[model samples]
Target chain A: MIQRRPDWLAGYGLLSPAIIIMAVMMVTPLLAMVALSFWTQQGFELDRSFTLANYFALVEPSSEPTYWMGIPFPLTYPVPAILLIKSLAMSLAITLAVIALAYPMAYFLAFHVRGQKALWLVLLTIPFWTSYLLRVFAWKIMLGFNGAINSGLKSLGILTEPLSFLLYNPLAVMITLIHAWVAFAVLPIFVSLDKIDRSYLEAATDLGDSRLRRFLQVTLPLSAPGTIGAALLVFIPTVGDYVTPTLVGGPSGTMIGNLIQELFLKQNNAPLGAAVSITMMVTIAAIVTLFLWLIGFRRLRSRAR
Target chain B: MQRIKFIDRMASGRIDRRTMLRQAGAFGVGLLVLPRLPQAAEVLTCLEWAGYDSPDYFKSYTAKHGGAPNFSIFSGEEDALAKVLAGFKADVMHPCNYSVNRFVNAKVAAEIDTTKLSNWKDVFPALQMASGVVMDGKVVMAPADWGNSSIAYRTDLVDPEYAKNESWSIFYDDKYAGKVCMLDNEIAITIGMMVGGEKYETAAVATGEKLAAAAKEWGTKVVKNSRFLWNDPSELQQALASGEVVAAYAWNDVYRNLKRENIPVAYAKPKEGYFTWFCGLTMLNTGKADPALAYDFIDAWLSPDTGKQLIEGSGYGHANMKSFEISDKQAITDMGITDPAEHMKQGTLLIQVSDAVQTEWNKAWGDLKALKQ
Candidate 1:
């Protein structure tokens, strides 16, 4: 009998690189944050003693008016809960706006372009080539009180004074975010739309379905995975984004991410920040899980398979 | 520069084709054969604010030591403290007066032998004796420069009624809603203290005894009125110049720069008093560089020549009093440092509040900052 090399070794060897990288890059930081969340910080010294004070502080109640929706939030430490909800709400709006905006462009690229589809895609992504900060800065200038729009409109005798409602508002934040994250949303939806089999649409048409009917029944279902995937990608990251809000959100622009930053850097309460981060992650995870469950995730996934 | 060096080496007959090839081969062989080693640590790394690394500030030291010390730039002292605490080594670090004790408390900053610094005596005695600069008879930080935090408002855009009165309430003025910029720092809290009608002290800030209601009102009103929170001075300057905002909480440089551009601007001498800051250098305990060299570098920074350059260039009040006499008179006036010595004596300086106070202040700030958003 000849000894044979185990096939499992090759499989494991192939997976080892990703595993090691994940372990070092993702898993280690996550574990460190979890550990830090339980530790107490006294000035420069960190007490390794396990305590739940940081977590408790996050929910310590105050006499301020209860939140209208009754989210059971601690009124005293309301910043985190409020920011989280605001972030989630804004991120959802951003996602919906992005999907609504990108789908048409993706659909056009997928079906309408006779040739140079790559060129069209390349052109679409040109706006994304510049730095994100630069793009946000451009928006700031455009939406500023004395910005281009105001000056141009003023010169045209449209108004006496610059519009005060233009920048440093939620609308400005949402608009900038939708623009920034649209590129990311476009690619996935485009891939899904492009991968749709023509025969399915032909079959729908042969069944005497109108163009709109065919799209709603066949094309839409086939492309659900990409649109949903793009949404998840955009929503998850945007929920934690601080940069855009900081630049444009004005008084209302600060999100949970900014609060997290405050805790870690400015407030010198790393443990609290870590706890808040964990809380946010859990909340997002719950929301995402429920959304997937409601949308029949298993059935959709099986169909994809 | 490397090309020039190679050419010079070749022109000087130090390296020809044959020798160059021989050296290259030797270097490659040595790299492969020898054990890798860490490069030698820089002799004197000084972690400083951007533009503070200019050779003019330390020309005296450079002349004596053959070259300028290694410089690392930081935007904020909190960031600098974070870096230093995380083991970023430098012989000297520049931290503002309020935060000197933070470094000392963390044990990242070492005491200076004032005896080593010849120009130490010439730095205004008041600045040298500022609260956090000296602790328990040990000099932790040598006073270098100071800047004022006050309102810089467009004379053309703002109402004369508000500007006429020296009050921080200009920030809370509803007439300028969505048209004001503000500093997003502890200085804002001090501004809040002023608005709250309570005299600012560590005691009031540390214990929200009388400031809670006032702080809430201030935060609500100020955030409502402010168009944005400015982190960079340039942002405030641009906002003011563009007529985007009628007023902003600004440093002295913003006033000077706006003045130079012929903008109708005025630095507010608020009745609440300006938030004056004295930032300076402190030796790091972890520094392996020669103490004498670090001392020399510090002395150079304290020299009147450097002070004049600092005053004329950046519009900051240098610690050395004699620099006032030698500096450009107009520039000094523009910097509002013509009578800096007198001002320093009467200035409302920042203090290092206790940790409990810091936590309360931060909590209040976080609540207030997030409340409107």
Candidate 2:
């Protein structure tokens, strides 16, 4: 009675469809983006001139200082360098803020609450069920000088006049983005927390470890992967976002995404816009790769023990 | 054992070979055929501003014509131009005078044959030759609608005495710092340059340095005080109705809507002179359909009766002079045009700037944004 082994060729056949689809959909677009970064537009049509001018413009400093002694200083211009810096700062700020608010809420659902986990998840997702633009608009109304918040405060005699710091500023943009992306940060952390085995906590406690210590040594390390994934998920999209900034950010709150939009839409400079996009993509990829490598190296060292 | 193994191996090989071949064939066929599908439509499509193609205004024309004109509205000239360059198929476009040169330079629009338009003589001469309208020694746009950018404020919130005066300085006052509003567009920002006594040059020819200097100086002031920089008329309306803003740079149509809703709003006559924009319709090279339909649509829009309907519906002034006779003079007066000729003379037409100048302007805007409180 001899048995036949399973065929490896059949398994490859099953995966070929997905492999082909990915090459056409994802790989081709990425190649095109890289190619477009090098091409410049002549009038309306794109010309295939391979030039480093776009990349040079991105990293170059202003030709003149913004101000001088006594006399009005020559105007200082913002190149791609400044825009990229500003975008990174805004994205990081939003990511940190969201994580700070979401982690505790996710923890409450996973550990503190017994059953009602499904109920709370639905509540967390309620804000997102509405239109994205509408939700932002609602936030704008609530924060406006004559909005409910200011009106309520005025009625309570908390202050004399409507608060001027309500909307159309960096604070407004930050707050709105946090509200918009809270669900994104919460779900991942929740899943990570849920996956932690109860036996690990029991083992730590049996050894006379404190509750905080148990969490710090065991739970935090286990959830690092989810935390990193959530951070990237929020950071990458927020960096390229223009809608929120445009609606809520005043002149002082303009971001790199706004500049990219202006270049492609208003200035008709696609090559320069493409250059900015490529630079951002590469920067994000490098940072993410470095982070993963560090995590992998640590895992290997721990396993050796 | 050998017989069973041979049968299993044969089945696996057949399956793998068949699947791989099918995928390759599908991919090759899709790649070859996808790029050639005609994205261009057989009929002319007009890309216009939002209110230009309201159902009330164009329903009659659509019914009379064999087929209704295809139209899509854009928020701004830059948005329209961006869509066109992205290979959006449109046979005609409605951009303001300031943007015509860029359209022509980009070869997105075709030169107009003045003879094709029966109402060509009715167009305002200033609009026909405005710095933004010239392209290769030809008139590329037939003027469609005209309006002035003026200050709109809440009569109840702003003091009546201060509202009567015409001054750009009003927007900079501390009293209105948190209550005031302005457009987040280059044209509105350039008004600050005009008030500062900067020499006027067509944006198409202005040097990058000049634009940057103007942007930096004006941007600092505008950003420091502006409570909100609105992107659309609706946003301005929200600001006004909610009392978040007592005063703002606005169009006549905005004032008209507020008035109809019984909200207290009025247009101020700024002393420095109002900044104005003139928009017109022009044919694009992409139109493969009857150019006649495009011509008919323009003709209908310019006719006295149709022009009256458009003005009344959209609250924008008609380019056709005859339409004024049919429209109520009192209504026009309420729109802040007591004397059309005088207003036109005192007004400055917004001009399109070259790419280099625009870059300088953006830098200046950035510097202003970077200013510390």
Candidate 3:
């Protein structure tokens, strides 16, 4: 006689390896980070205590007064809060710009270009084949004061003076991020666009609908998942990006990730770094959740199901 | 390169097609039959910076032992400390004076038996008892390389008069507004302390209140005026070379590199004082290392021959005075160290501040960077 096994048992068995891996690799570190967020760091020691001081320090004011233009200004803005807000704003800008640039290219690849689509896609990803650090360095070279663009423009008599505005600013950081991570945006949008049934457009045409109307009615709604995916892919990573900013993001362009890196690396304050990391992660997760909600989470779930 | 090698092999005609095929089959069989073996332990493991691992610096040890010590290199001391504390067992670890205290306090580094070290007497007297090297009258570190953090200006771009009267405040001067760069580290904040009139002792161990006050003064002046903050050597070089930045808070090596190319750059002896730092070796308390071998490694690193090689090859000042004997006065002057002892005394050494102070300094820096206006 054979004993009947529960179906869920088989499912659990199939998922055990992945579950174990995720638990070990992702969840453990996340839990440790959470624990560390509550701890405090002294000169060379980590004091494990259940205190909210690390988080509080994020909002602690500099009691000293700063005078800008002879008007007394209080140090009301906490560093962490300002950095968080700055990172969010910058990431949003980069995400929007990347989507704006990539959507058209992806659409062109998926819908318009008929020959050697694979080749075009491969060529699009050629820049990505090199290291991200290398690409960022290349951008630095290209955007420098006496860099390729400046020298080229100077040689062509486009301008007499080399432009200093091209590099080491928020604009440069945004430009580099778009170039570096735009491919991440492209592939997702391309997948969604490519998956759209051509018959839907044909049906709209048959119904005497205009192309714009057809896109608004069907194409836009159908590609929402991919667009959201693209936004998430670009927004989340760029928000925590310190390297690009450190490389090109002059005085004004420092991001939250730089602060965290300093705390963990240079300052040797792991607890503070942990707190910052947890806060940044939670903030990103919340933003992602809101984004999903705005784009109809239920619909996305149903589509996946 | 692999293609060239294949072509060469074919051209050589050492093996015909049949032989090559047979050999290929044999190789494929060999690959499957090959057994994995445990690696032999190499004594005198040192975790250090890039240039320290050069064969020239460790010739005596390699020549005697028939192998170079195992090496694991770190770009920064913070990383080295973290790795060592996290159970990375190296016989010796390289750390600067600023970070040696952390290693000692954490017990990742054991007190060095200086009596066992032959070249211990040769290390600079100032560095022998430098802030982090000596704790409780015990020398925990064998001091090695030293360099100064000073202002490096393009002689052609910056005025000779202004460069002559070098002040830390030059970094914040509105006259050089987009033409100035600063190092992206806490060292800048330390420079800021000096710029804000904080004393050396106060600056070295500044706590929350002191840090805030200092930051309020210095942050407003310098942080905003900086065109960029560079950490990488190449980036700093590019900025100066292209006339993008006329002046930068940089290491002595930057001065050396520029002058080598005849780029008309000068290292400033800032009136506030040059920010000097020294790096050295410490024996890790890993309990795995053979103590005798570790002592030998330290001695070899501090030996006159090694010191000579370090200065000649890496263009850094070694702790041993005998090392300077190998070089001419011109080379010494060019290195911005005409008198080592005098220079060390004149320069303010970077020391480990309380973690609380570090946090405050970091916060101030963050606010400075976040300052839009």
Residue range with the least summed lDDT across 10 consecutive positions in model 3 chain A: A1-10
By lDDT, who's the top model here? 1
Give per-residue CA lDDT, model 3, range A38-122, as digits (tens): 9998766789879998888776667765554354444454566667777899999999999999999998998998989899889
TM-score of 3: 0.83
Candidate 3 wrongly placed segments (more than 4 Å): A1-7, A59-77, A297-305, B1-37, B42-56, B61-91, B124-132, B196-199, B275-277, B286-296, B310-315, B333-339, B346-373
The best candidate in terms of TM-score: 1
RMSD, candidate 3, Å: 9.5
The TM-score-based order of candidates, best leading, equals 1, 2, 3
Candidate 2 lDDT score relative to the true structure: 0.72
DockQ of 1: 0.22
Superior candidate under DockQ, 1 versus 2: 2
User: What are the models' TM-scores?
Assistant: 0.87, 0.84, 0.83
| Per-chain TM-score of candidate 2, chain B | 0.79
Best by DockQ: 2
Cα interface RMSD of each candidate: 15.0, 6.8, 15.8
lDDT by residue (tens digit), candidate 2, A1-305 = 22332466656655667988999998998788778889886656788889887787665555564342133333333445555666787888999998888888888888888988899899989988899999888887788777879989989999778887877777888888888998999999989988899899999999999999998999888887777778888988988778887787776566778777877776677887888888888877887788789889998998899
Q: After superposition, how far is residue A96 of candidate 1 from its true place, in Å?
A: 0.6
Model 3, position B323, has a per-residue lDDT of 86
Over B1-373, each residue of candidate 3 has an lDDT whose tens digit, in order, gives: 9556644544444334454466567868999988968766546778877556778876777777788788987756666776665567788888888877767777788888889988888777877777777878888888888878888898888877976688878876789888888876655666777776777667766666666676667665676667777656667887788788889988766777777888989888888887777888888887465788788778888888887766665467888878888766666665766445666677877777654554566556656665544
